[model samples]
Target: MKKHQWMATLLSLICTGLGMFYIGTPGMIIGGMLLMALQGAALFIFFMTLGYLGLIIGPLAIGIHIIGLIIPVLYFSYRSPRKPMFDEKRRRQLSSPWKIVVRTIIGLALFAGSIYAGYTWGSAPFMKTAAEKREVQEAAESYLEQKYNEPFKVTDVDYTWAIGSYNLTAHPEKAPELEFTLSSNDASPPAISNDTYLNQLWGQQLRDRLKPLLDELYPDQAFGEAYVFAGSDTVERDYSRLANNADGDVSQNVRLIVFADLTADNLAQEKERVLELIRRLPSVTVPGETDLTIDYYAADLKTPESVKKVEQDIDDMKGKTSTYSFRVFDISDITSADDIEIRGLE
Candidate 1:
């Protein structure tokens, strides 16, 4: 039986290398199996990674699909099937309108089925219902409380499919800002890390403690968002971040991004104000090894976009944050603002 290239290509269009069955040559059958296997592997990975692996697997699957669509165009050695497909003896008589219509319906059904499978199996795992989210939240809360022997609250449960776990934002009853991230996927045990919780805890405390100091020094709100972070030592030793430690390098270290506005009008005045602030920073009791990114903007030029990203928005600024921002200036990682020596300015 002569193979129909159009029939094979159309079948393969619905599924990669599906047309090979119609052609039925040994080489075609082998190629079809390999391409089909590749498609299956891609599907498995897409499910396992919860769709993140799609980008990595897309090209390979697409390449196979493309090949399946176009490969029928090239001439191949045609062979008869072991059991004659469609009963070649009755080919002419069964070429009636009803037979043709039935075949068309079957083809359409196949195409539709492929699409349905793609949606149902591929997406169903990642999408959870509200009840499922609530269940996960309860489970995570229970796990955290038992693990730490402390009362905790689960604010929300969110499934991050990229990592295949439900990420829970939770906090101890006493301190909400000192929140911890816990993950669960129901199959394995709920995972919680003390290291992550402690780091977040210390960072929150440092930020809170620094705010009052800023209020006293720069009373007119001269400073902006101060991302105060503690080093690994603070996380490990579990030191109270709020405690005043004059120790040079113990636990507290700030891998910090802070915004300090230049108060003066002219450039010279701005330099002087910045220098003064730099001199005063040492006295401010920021102990341990500290690195600072002090983004400087003009006091007058401070927009919601301009200063600290979103400390103040004079333009009816309540929630107009998350807008695109250009850097007013980039003085990042200046450990000692006093140690800065600009050749031209100096």
Candidate 2:
């Protein structure tokens, strides 16, 4: 049979080095087949290493295929004319039948392996175990329950095995308005910090206890909202201690940040009312801790000038000793009404 140069070139374009086999060029055929095998293997490995490894192997596989395509085209164009097409001398120089068969088999095997590898990588994300799916759902439900103080149902868990991550959709019974979808790769949900948990628990208790009294005292609700935070006093100590090795005798501090819409007219009256409210608060005692150092901050959100003045007053009192234990600040200058960072005070 006559070997057509154009047909060989077209085959090479379709499949790297395939044209060389048709053209009866042993050297070009071997080189093209090797390039094709390398490209296939690189692609398979790239899919297997989906995350960061893809960053490396992905480019390598692409480069191999590009080189494979170019090499075959160049070989066909440059060497085809010099070598006799279907002459008896050229036929004698062509590879033996057994050697061609062996090379073809090896190349086919490599190609098949690469395709299988890619298929496995693509399907991995959808092939998560039932137990893994359940774990992801449970994590989402647990997080929602802790956050909203209600029962939560995880509706769906989408596990992506390739990336080793999962996304969960949950619905809180009490809080229907809130979106409770959570995503993570961790085996379990993150633990709540001891200090934060304690602060939130104690804060809720304080709010429940003081709500009625506060409502009666301030009928007009001039005090916007009183949020009390209870946590261990990390400051007021000359020395530092590691979080795990914290001192037991360290005092527990209760800070009542009162958000009040105070104008120049009712500033003094509101300040007095806050002080009275503080005085009425019963001393709280926690086990294995010194007395609670209760402090107050009356945030004046009415005007910027009033806020600035209060800020200056706090600044002046920073180094000086005060007769009163509870302190107050006009946080009008602060944009967020919820911000009440007074613990930084000396």
**Winning candidate number (TM-score):** 1
Candidate-wise lDDT, in order:
0.53, 0.48
Which run of 10 residues does model 2 get worst, by summed lDDT?
235-244
Q: Per-residue lDDT of 1-346 in model 1, one digit per residue for the tens?
A: 3446677677778777666544554565567666666666677667757767778878877997898777755633334577466346323333455644554454445445654565566666677778777777777777766666778888877777667677778888877755667667744344544325554655555555555655665564444333333433332323443334323343333322223332224435434444555454445434544343333333455455544444432223333321111121223334343445422211
RMSD of each: 9.2, 14.7
Q: All candidates' TM-scores?
A: 0.47, 0.36
State model 2's lDDT.
Answer: 0.48
- Candidate 2 residues lying further than 4 Å off, grouped into runs, are 1-33, 44-59, 78-131, 138-167, 172-177, 183-346
Clashes by residue pair, model 2: none
Candidate 2 similarity to native, TM-score: 0.36
Record all residue pairs in model 1 with backbone atoms less than 3 Å apart, i.e. clashing: none
